[model samples]
Target chain A: MAREKRRWVAYGLTVPSYLWLAVTVFLPLIVMLYFSFLSKMPFGTAEPVLTLKHYKSFLDRDFYHFLTWRSVKLGFHVTFFCLIIGFPAAYILARKVHGRWREAILLLIVLPFWSNTLIRIFAWTMVLRTNGLVDQMVHAIIPGAPSVGILYSYPAIVIGLVHSFIPYMILTCYISLQAIEDSMIEAGRVLGASSLSIFWRIILPLSLPGVVVGVVLIFVPVVGAFMEPRILGGRQSIMLGTVIEDQFTEVFNWPLGAALSFILLAIVMAIFAACYPLLRNRMKLT
Target chain B: MTRWIAYGRRIVGMMAGLAMLGATSVAVADEVRVLNWKGWGTDEAWAVAEFEKQTGTKVVHDYITSFPETFTKLRTNPGYYDIVVLNAAFVEKAAREGLIQAVDPAMVANSADLYPDMRDTPQLNFDGKVWGIAWVWGGTSVTYDTEVFKTPPTSLDVLWDPAHADRVCWRDNAEDSVRFAALALGQNPDQPEDLDAIREKLRALKPQVKAFWKSGDEWLKLVAAKECDLSIVWTNNTEAAAVQDNLPVSFIVAKQGAVAFRDGLAMPTNPPNAKGAYAFMNYLISKEFYAGWVKIGGAPVSANSKAVEELPDSSLTRQVLTQPDAIKRLNFKGPLSDEERQTYLDLWQETKAYFAE
Candidate 1:
């Protein structure tokens, strides 16, 4: 009877979360799919008349395909950059740093995030402005070498996204890295493995799980990033998120926005599906 | 044991006495709920105090930085605010959507004293029915550091000048860039058909900009720090930062007029206290109150020319603050058909890409 009561209590706890997911997540996506086929009202609301016209617009041979390809490229760039930087940083935090110092370093990683995300992006803009800190530093380092302000460029957007999200990647990878057993490395060395060989054979394989999580966590959002690209990236940095934002804010085309959102979701899911098989194989091999 | 029980009884009595004292304390007064944009509606606290001193109405003001967020709150829970400051575009949109109630302008005697220009703006009214009272009139203008540019570059072409590379800031939105570029290229910013040209113009300018600012504070800091040479900004924002923060900046009346906008006061359609909300809107438009609010907020009021004349040295007001001529030149953008808007957005994105390239 006590076991039955505990089971009932467990069910009760799970129900609210399930209900919340249904209301906030599943319901919205379902509604979005429904709306994606509807005509946009003059005042920017959705109408009852369903049509495939919006999807047909998306099939524009020139424009739609180009944006989709560009978006995937930008998303890949962000993910790759984050992984290259974040992995080393996470390793240092998880395997190298001592107790209190590690805690202190972790605090520093999260300190900037305490500010509003928008404000933090703007801070980078201030640093990267033409006469701003970065430009001044560049001028000081190489006199008359043509000052380079990084703001509003593709590099700036990539750098800003990396800076803002690298901490998340590091923290995520750190958890997985910390779970790694020290004896495993010693065992690899005992089997006549050098530092590089041990890292390649043992460490890299073990960390694949973390790498997968980090890539998905960072890549999914970076694909749809709006503010970072819009702020740091000049007109050239129009990513997928900016497109979605424009549809809703300026165009008032909910159906089109919904359709775009679904496309983004499908793209993300495809990436996840493609990655899942590889991750599972790697997990088993490791 | 008997002595201990007696002592415990006395302690319990004292604790009960303290609890009773806490419960009996005078009920704290409820605050009047208000919602509006940050800089503009903050004076409501002072107004509330003044109102309380005179007519004993307790006012509590809450500010929201986002238009959609505020509208969402109003739509979902109309009782959340006694008053809301709305953009004229959203005012009409909301009223048409039945998200807000029709306000009877007769109740607001001060609104009758408004400038003829404001009352007649088609965006501010629907079928001769007023939805909101004018609060502040401002718009996007070209602003720069006087020290850097020396003389203000008059034309929008300056934004696209390759020599100005990495020294420009824009609105950080494709649609805004498209609109500005279309206008710059002598294409109609409002017309959807002009999007392709706008995109072409933007592509040309993308290389010049260093950043696109999304917030007023970000724009202010960028200009103040001399990060970028120029930014397209709202007049009040540049004015407040320059005059108040002493930022080295000036708003320029570009050769081609800029985007002009009006923000106004409106009662939510189903406000919990409609009478109080109307009274608040009425009080906001009184010439004396309007002038005072504008002075502190550094926002241009839509009051009559005579009311503006009453302020001393207001000539040195924010560059666009008093520029009716600038307003005349502006091609105000209104709500567009969804398809047309989508096409414009596509053009905007295309333009942004061209600029970046």
Candidate 2:
């Protein structure tokens, strides 16, 4: 009787949170799915009919295919760059730095989160535009170098995205690295392991979970980002996210937009599913 | 455990009480909520304040950047807004969707003060019923750096000139870009006889464009920075670049004519405060408010003739408004049919793809 009462109490404790999630997340997702199969927005005066034409439109247009590929490629490039730059900085902070200075550095690394992201991206234009700060500085240094203004270029988009998301990578890696005891390194050294070997065999495999977490966190959102690319990439940018945005905002085609969104969600889920087994085995080994 | 449950119940009770209080206060207040674009000139705040004092009804403003946003907001949150200022192109669609209601001229006392052309404009009136009141209008003209061209270019051909390759910016909008291209080719932009030829022309002009700007501010920034020598921009933006930012730029109506756009004030269907909305709409057309709108907002002309006559001769309004030829050159084409709009969008997508490659 006591055990039965305890289970009831536990169920009561979780019911509110479960109900909140159902209302906010699951309900909208189900509605989007329903809308995706409709011929028109059911709310407006237009007659609504059940159809698969919205999904078929994606397959019919090569533009949508190209944009999806581009978005995926962009995600890979951003994730690769973030890992390349972030892992080293995180290592230094976790293993080399100590006490108050380490905390200060970590805080400084996280400072970008305090300000609005759109404002920061806009500020980059001032640095990268013609006759702006960077150009003037370059001219001052070389006395007449060709203008290096690269705002509205693909590189500028990547730079802005990296600046915005590198903190996530650094923070995730730092937590995992900090958990590694110094005694483990000493033990490896006593066993005649080289620094490279130690890293390859011990540290890296152990930190795979954190790296995977950071990759998922950064890659998923970057694939769906429209504003960063629009502001920085100009005419050069066209991603699945922006195309979806155009459908809803410019075309007023809600059914098609919802269909496209579900496709993107499916792609992201497939990627995660593909990576899951490898990540699980690695975690078990560690 | 019992104590924790008691605390939770108290919190829920307090939240319910707070929600009830909010509901009652909203019911008691006399407020007119307006959904409009941001930056309606310096005089708007002052005019709104004066209107509130005179009518004893609080005016609330919600700003959106695009027509689609206005439509989406109204569709999702019905009865939340009293009035909306949208483009004339959207007025028909909004009315057809039952998102907005017909305007009663009797309610708006200043309806007779509108200029003859604006008062009976087919864009605002559809199916023999007036759905919106014309508010502000402007034209898209060629804005070029004075330093680059000593004499202003007379024709739209300059945008496609080989000598100006990589020195021009075009607005990244489907309708405007397609229409401008059609006009440049001497075709009727309203109903282009040959869409394929227009598409080819746009594709050919891709090499000359430095960037496809999405916003007025972006266009101004590119011009001010000398990143592009010329661009097709709104007249008000050009005015702002020269007068406000002191950028070395000048605007001219090309020989191909300019695309004119007018935004209208319409009442949303089943507004929370319809009386207040009508009063505000009437005040917007009054001589005092129109005068302030022209001066503070840098509007080229007011729909009210009396407001235009009141402006000084040296003002931009006097120069643009007095020129009947400039007004004649304005192309005020109505909205495209759904099928036509889709075709234009497809062509625009293809153009963007070509440039991307």
Candidate 3:
């Protein structure tokens, strides 16, 4: 009787959280799924019939294909840039720097988060535009060097996304790097392995789990990021995410928007599934 | 266990007290809920304050970043709005959906002096009812750097000029792009005969574009930083840049013409506070309100003909809006059916994608 009562209490404790999740997350997704299959919005006097046309829009059109590729390319570019910029800084702090210095450097790395993302993205426009701070500085140094008018282009979008998301990579990799024992590196060095080989064989593989997590965290949102691309990418701003946004906000085509969202969710899930085995071997996910 | 139960009871009591506090505040004030773009004329802090003081009714506002978002909000939540501020092109659609109700123009005391061109438009009147009070109107056209162009550029083709390549900016809106491209091609901007030609023209012009600006402030920033020598921008933004901010930009209606627009106030259907809604609408269209908003130049030009008289001739609002030639050349874009808008949106997006390639 006591065991059954304890079990009941445990379930009672979990039921509220499950209920909250159902209300907050699963319910809206189910509603979105239903909306995705509708012919028209069933608000007011208009009658809508069930249909596959919304999904068919994805299948029939080449526009969605091009936009999807654009978004994926953006994700890759941002992830790659974040890795290159973040890994070196994270490593030097994690392995070389000690005591309060590491803490101060880490604090500076994440300091940009105190300001809003939109403000940071807007700040880049001042730096990247023609005759902007970048151009003025370049001209002063080089004496009539051509202006560095890089804003409102793909490169500008990449720079903005990297600035916004690189913190994730640094922090995640820092945590993983800190967990490594100093003895492991010392052992490798005693075996007469060069510094490059010790890092390549010992340090990189062990710390990769954090890098993977950071890549997943950064890649998912970067692909669906509308504001950075819209604010910085200019005429090249139309991506899969922006198109989906326009469908809901500008076109009032909820069915199409929901359908597009489902497609994005599916794509992200497939990527995770492909990466799951590798993650399982490295991290505790198994 | 007994002490834990007492703690739980105290927490519950505190929550209940907080809820009551919220409820009593709502009960004490009569509120007229308005839905509009944030900080636009209707929701300006000073205007809201004045209205609240005079009428003893508190004003609350909800904002929308886009027009379709406005329609979605109205549809999903009925009886939640007293007033909806919409572009005139959307008024007819809003009425047909019964999201908003029509009022006789005679009801508004200041309606007598409203400009016939902006006020008595088919877009704001349909099914034999005046659905919205035309509040402010402006032009969306070419704005160029005076420092770069010694003489005013006359044609829309100036956007595609190689000289301004990497120095041209355009609005990042599909409808605006479609309408502007149509006008440039000498096709009816309201209903273009050929969209493929417009698509090709836009794709070709993409090489010259420095940016596709999303907001008026961004356009000013771009122009101020000398990133854009030529741009398609709203009239009021250009006025502020040149007249107020000492930028070298000049607002001009190209020989082909410019896109004209009106934003107005309307009564949403089944408003909880009908009397308060009417009082607020009257104040919005009042001469004093328009004149005050125009002086700031943060808002669009007044749609009231009488209000324009209140501004000095030196005021850019008076000078830019009072020109007969500019008025004559204005090509006000009309409302589009869902299918038509979708077609234009698709073409616009496809052209943008081609540009990316």
Candidate 4:
């Protein structure tokens, strides 16, 4: 009886998280899957009749494929940009900076994230707007150069997403870089290796794990990002997120929305699966 | 043990007495809780005072910020409100879903007091039965910074000009934005069922737009920053932002015209205070009340055309989204079958993709 009661208590303890996931994640996925195979009702309601009309609709259009490719491209650009800038910053902070200054600098790098996400995006908008700070500075510097405001462009959208997610990449790399013993680099240096060779041979190989984690964390969401592109990007920068959102909210085609979401999910899963074997090899080789 | 049992029986009797008292209060129909659009609810304190003076019923008001939230809340908790304000697009859906109750004209005597045009507007009646009462109507148009442009462009064609490319803003809302672009492209999205050509035109104009604003706060911020010189915006949001923030913005009736909209008041399927709701609706439609509301930027249904004339021109009216005459040239957002609407939305997504490319 005591064992049974303890079991019940353990189950009860996990109920909240399970319920939350069921409501927000699992249930929605199930509903979306069911709808993806259905026909659209005349009043924008999902019909009870089962059909693959929405799936076929998505397949028939070349636009979805184009959007998916664009999103993947944007995601790669963000991941690559973050890796280039973030890895070096993390190395300097983790290896070079000492004692209190290191902690303070790291804190400074992450301090801006405490503010609300939406407010941060709005701040970016202000900085990028015409006659705003960036444009004003440009005019002052060039005198007669046409003002190039960053607002409503793909560059602006990418910048906002990068600025918001860069800290994740930095922190991940910092931990990985910190985990490597100082002796490993020193040993490489003592073996007639130059400073650059020591880093390339030892530090670069060790940091792959953090790089994988950071890449997945940023890449998955960036591909699905809607608000950043919608608010900052002009007509020339629609992402997959916008397409999925239209299926649910304005179009009332929940089924199509669900299908689009699954398509994205499938793509994300496929990438992760394909990367696993390669990542394992890197882990073992390093 | 006998004494303890006697005490328990007395406690049960007392609990039953309290339950009876609670039931009596419910039967009295004392308080009416209302759920509605942000600005359209009865002046809660004022309505409470007036209802108390006349019918001895109290009023409770709950305001929802957005239309989707309101619909979701109503469908989820139907009994939470005695009445709600829904737009034409939603009224049919709400009625068909049986989320709202049919309003009996006899209960709401002031139903006759509403202007005939408003009385018969598709917003209030879904298939001949009264579903809601038309309260306000307005149109969408381009709001621009007059100070920047010497002569603020009157035509939607200005939006397509290469010179103005990347200088224009549009509503982020898909339904309105799609129609606005279609009309700007010289296609009557409201009238024609054939939207393929309209879709292509909107897709072509995508490169010219700078940003899609999602909120009034963002619109104000965009204009203040000079990030955008021109925007396709609603009259209420533009007027409120301009008047409140003292922004250098003015709205105009785009030459191609834009979609007009209306929102109305309706009762839910089962109301807690049905009689009191009827009493409040009656008081809301009085000419004195209606005129006072419109003067303060509330677009009351002008049942008596003289009521509109009675409204003093605020400096803002000179720059409303569209004049009544301009409204005539535009397409009315009447009934759209589900398939027809989805096609438009699909085209909107397609057009968005074209611009994105």
Candidate 5:
């Protein structure tokens, strides 16, 4: 009787969470799948026409293939740049800095979060555009220099995305780094290990879980990123995400958008499946 | 265990009370809510306040970010909205979907004063009933920096000119991109005689394009930075930039004419406050309201001819529109069917891919 009561309690506690997930996540995904098979948008009393043409068109088009590659490449580039920049900052904050100063500096790191993301993107335009902030600063430093107009390019997209997503890498890595015992590093030093060797052999391996999590969080959204690419990349901004968005927003073809979204989801799942083993082991530490 | 049961019951009671509060507010009959682009027509605070003064009903608004979103909001949340602002192209689709109902002419006397061409379009008339009430309209055309070109290019051919090609900005929308390219190729925008010509023309022009802008904010940013020499822009945005922003730009309707679009007001199906909605819609399209809207600045040309006529000669809307010249040159955007739009969008995506290549 007691065991049954405990089981009922468990179900009562978990039921709300499961219900929330069904409503927010699974239900919408199922609806999208249904919409993907529709031949056209059914209106008024008209019967819905279902077909497999939306999927067929994806298979047939070289445009979708090229855009998919571009979006994935973009994800890789942003993830890589964030790691190279954020890992060091997080390491210093965790190891080198201490107490009040560390807290203040950590607060400084999160300062940009106060402003909205769209505003931050627009702000970057003012800095990167011709004869704008960057140009003004450079021209002040060196007289008669040509402007470094980097706005509306592939590099600008990378820069904007990295700035937007780097905080994830920093905060996640900081959590892992803070958990590492000082005694472990002391033992490594006592065993006559150099700083670089200690880092490669122990510190990086210890922080692997946080780094992987951060990579996933940043990479997934960056792959589906449309606004940053369109704002910063301009004419060169076309990607799988932009194409999918255009289908719904511009072309008014919900079926094509749904099909493209499912294809993207499948590709992301395949990538995660390949990495699952390594991720499982590393994630256990946290 | 007994204490926890009491706690659970109290939480449930609180939630039920909150739900009841939401229901009561929504059930208010005197409130007429409209959905439209922010600060456009019906949402104009002054106009809405004036309506509220005469009619006891409260006028409220919710803003839509895109055309598809307007449909989603109305269909998903029935009785939430009473009116929606639709572009000329969307009236038929809205009516066909039963998302909106036909507005009787008796409901709006001001609608009679709307330009005959706008009131009598096939897009508005179907099954002997008008789907949308004509509101305001303007053209999509080229705006050039006076600083860059001493002599303003008089024709659409200026877009393809090699000397000025490196600084041209095009809108990123597929339908508009296809339509403009068709116009540049001397083909009908609605049903282009040659689809292949549009594809080739877009590919050839891709090299010259400095950037593509999606929003007015981005277009203005590009202009301020001198990143573009010529850009495809809406007439209202051009007037604002030249007059308000003090940008040295010239708005010109090319010899081929501008791509004209009209904004209209439509009634959503089974509104919570249909009587209040009609009164609000009637007040929005009146000549007095339009005259006030023009004074407010950033107003599009009025659909009612008399409303436009009332504006002073110094009004920027009057000077830029030049009704005598503009009326003749206005090239209405085709009410292209869904299948045709899909085809145009497909070709446009292909052209963009080619641009990337």
Candidate 6:
């Protein structure tokens, strides 16, 4: 009887949060799914007919296919770069750094999260544009160096996204890496294991959970990013997110946009599903 | 635990009461909410202050970056905004869809001072009723770096010139891009008889484009940074770049003619504050307001004839405003049929895809 009362209390505490999610996230998604199946907007004089035409649009257009592939490729490139850059930084913060300086360094690593992301992206344009800071610096060193304007290019897009998302990776990895006891490394070293072996066998396996979590967190949002690419990549940017944005904003085709959103969500879910076994193993180890 | 729960319940009750009080206060307030593009509202802050002082109605400006956002916001929150400033081309659609109402001429005291061409334009009227009052107008023209070109580019064909390959920027808008391409090909941009030819022309110009800018700020940055030598941009952006940023750029109408657009104020259907809306609209077009608007807003011209005459002839704003020849050469793009719009969208998609490759 007492346990039943305690369970009810826990459920009551969670009910408000679950209810909020239902209204904000789940309800809109269900409505979007309904809209995706409709031929035209139900608003105004248009008679709503249930149809697969919006889905058919995806299949019929090769450009949509290309954009989907491009978005996925962007997700991979950003995730790869983040992991390569973030893991070492996180490891050093977790293992090497000590005392109050560790706290200061970690604070610095996650500081970008405290500021506005759009403003940060805009700042990059100032640094990367022709006659911008980078160009001026390069000219100062090499006097009459060729233009180093990298703004409005694909590289700029990747650089901006990586800068924005790297903190997520570092934070996650730092948490997991900090949990690794110093005695474990000492034990491996005493067992005649080389430093490389110690990292490969002990540190890597232990931090895989954080790495997986970071990849999932960064990859999902980057795949749906439109603003960064639009601002930084310029004409070179043509991700599925931007196309989906066009449908709703410029084209005024909500049904098509809804369909495209579902396709992107499905792709993201499939990726998570494919990586579930590996993620599960890492979770177990942690 | 019981005491803590009681405290939490009391806190929640008090919060709900506070929220209700806030809601009631807002409901009792006499305010007019005007929706417009960012930086496109009343030119002077003092003007809004003056309007509030004259009438007890507080004027609120809700700024958006694009026209589509205006439609989305108005549609989702009906009766939430009293007045909306939009392009003239969208007035008919907005009225037909009941997003906005027919303007009552009696409400606008400055209607008589409006330029005849702008005031009597069919674009602002539909079914013998005015839907929007013409507010500010500007031209879309080629803006190029003076350092790059010794002489100003005379034609829209400069966008396709090989010498400026990978150094040109165009707007990423479907309507404007396709229209400009059609003009470049010497075809009627408004009523393109052959979309294929226009598509081919746009596809050919793809190699020359460095970027398709989405915002005026982006265009300014691209030109200011020397990242782009040429761009199809609004006259005001060029003006701001030259006058404000000290960017060496010149705004010139191409020989083939540039696109001119007029934005106007209209009341939404069943506005919550009709009187406040009318008051704000009148103040927006008043003669006293135009001088500050021309100076601060960087608007090329005012639809009010009296406002145009008031400006000094030597001023850049006055020069841009009083150019009857430039106005005559401008091909004012109007609303497209749904079918034509779809075709353009499809062509634009194809062009973007081609360029992406």
In model 5, what lDDT does residue B323 have? 60
In the range B1-357, model 3's lDDT, one tens digit per residue, is: 334334433433444455445533444358988889876777778888999899899888777888877886777567778889888888888888889998767767788888887788888877777888888888888888898999989899899889888788888788889888888899999988998888987887877987777767777777777778888888778877876788887777888889988888888888888788888888887778876776766457777877767666665545654488878888876777878877777787788788787
What CAPRI grade goes to candidate 4? acceptable
Off by more than 4 A, model 5:
A1-15, A41-43, A276-286, B1-25, B71-80, B126-130, B315-317
Q: Over the stretch B15-124, how does candidate 5's per-residue lDDT look in tens digits?
A: 44554456445455598888888756677778878887888788777777667667766665556678889887888888878888888868888888988987887888
Per-candidate Cα lDDT values, in order, are: 0.70, 0.80, 0.82, 0.72, 0.81, 0.81
DockQ of model 1, rounded to 2 decimals: 0.18
Residue range B7-62, candidate 1, lDDT tens digits: 33344344445544553334224434567666564354566666667645566556
Clashing residue pairs in candidate 5 are none
Among these predictions, the greatest DockQ belongs to 3
Proportion of native contacts kept per candidate = 0.39, 0.36, 0.66, 0.48, 0.41, 0.38
Comparing candidate 1 with candidate 4, which one achieves the higher DockQ? 4
lDDT of 4 by residue, B220-322 (tens): 7777767677888766666666666677777777667867776677888888778778877776655655555555552433443434555556645533533
The residue ranges of model 1 lying beyond 4 angstroms of the native Cα positions read A1-25, A41-46, A61-67, A92-116, A130-148, A250-252, B1-36, B41-53, B58-102, B120-135, B152-154, B161-165, B173-195, B267-270, B310-328, B332-339
lDDT of 5 by residue, A1-286 (tens): 9999999999999999999999889976876787787775543243456689999999899988988889989999999999999999999999999999999988988988888999999889888887879989999999899978788788989999999999999999999998999999999999999999889778988998789889999999999998888888866888889888889887668789999999998898788898898778765653
TM-score of the candidate numbered 6? 0.90
User: Each candidate's DockQ score against the native complex?
Assistant: 0.18, 0.27, 0.36, 0.23, 0.29, 0.30
Q: Write the per-residue lDDT of candidate 1 for residues A45-131, one digit (tens) a residue.
A: 322466787777777634555667667777898889888888999888888998899999999988977889888887897787677
Q: Write the per-residue lDDT of candidate 2 for residues B89-166, one digit (tens) a residue.
A: 889889988899898888988878888788778878889899998776777878888888999888899998999997
- In candidate 5, how many Å is residue B30 off? 2.1
Residue A115 accuracy (lDDT) in model 3: 98
- How high is the DockQ of candidate 6? 0.30
Error of 4 at B98 (Å): 2.4
Docking class of 2: acceptable
Candidate 2, superposed: residue stretches over 4 Å from native:
A1-11, A276-285, B1-28, B41-43, B72-80, B96-98, B125-129, B315-322
- Report RMSD (Å) for each prediction in the order shown: 10.8, 6.1, 6.7, 8.7, 6.3, 6.4
* Candidate 5 Cα deviation (angstroms), residue A52: 2.9
Candidate 3 segments whose C-alpha is farther than 4 A from its true place: A1-22, A190-192, A276-286, B1-28, B116-122, B125-128
lDDT of 3: 0.82
Identify the CAPRI category of the predicted complex in candidate 6. acceptable
Report the C-alpha displacement of residue A102, candidate 5, in angstroms. Answer: 1.5
